[model samples]
Target: MNITSTLVTCVDNWLQNLYTKMYSHHTETYENTVEVHVQETSSPLTKTLVLRILINEEHKQVHIPNIFIPLNFHRQGIGFGLIKEILKVANVYRYELFIVDMTPSFYDRLLNRNAQPAGYDAVRIDTTTRL
Candidate 1:
């Protein structure tokens, strides 16, 4: 993978439009919603979105509701890169990170990889785990 060509950006109006077009069924919105997108610059004229994560920053907490990476792009470190970027943001803001509705194994893998920034941890909340 060409890491130099990969770009991580926060959501804006243009991104919101693209996200809505891609995920029409996810209609719920939050006031503090933050989207982080991982795009690969395949060519000078084309940028492909390989991964996207929706996080809600509220009450000094960061809640990740969803993470999407195309099947073809899995295991390519795109998702990990996106999470690292989000971790940087969370570290700066000192927000407690929570992964909601995602498989616990994923969080475990991240933890095993030492992905969490210093003084910050990712909490997994789902049916199988309690707060």
Candidate 2:
């Protein structure tokens, strides 16, 4: 059987406040093409969530445009795992800049929030994770 077959189920209101805070409360419109991938696991055959990334080699940066975990899979480390995977790849490629393009509140919660220590153009947006 396909490992992704076992994944199932995929939000709220203070929940409303929290949601807005986490995702900009749907205030902005986004238009672009993003490469989306699923973070899957074997044995139990589970697909935790989806991640979107856009790499700009000319700018020497990796953009994590979106990271979404279904409601049923939230708080299960799926999101964190996805970020970690991207960061790993970014480091390997030696990308100098990492842009998150995500909510400011959510970016503060990431492990690499402080990865960029210096340089004026080194960081921007809550959408960044230093690799």
Residue-level error in angstroms, candidate 1, position 9: 3.8
Count of residue pairs whose backbone atoms collide, per candidate: 0, 3
TM-score of 2: 0.48
lDDT of 1 by residue, 1-131 (tens): 11111212332322353444343222223344543443333343333433334444345555665667655556765555555555555555565555555466766665565444222345533222321
lDDT leader:
1
**Candidate 2 residue-wise lDDT, 7-53, digit = tens:** 11011111232333232222111232233333233323443324445
lDDT of each: 0.44, 0.42
Least accurate stretch of 10 residues (summed lDDT) in model 2?
2-11
User: What is the Å distance of residue 100 in model 2 from its true position?
Assistant: 2.5
Model 2 regions lying over 4 Å from their true place: 1-34, 37-49, 111-131
TM-score of each: 0.48, 0.48
Prediction 1 TM-score vs. true: 0.48
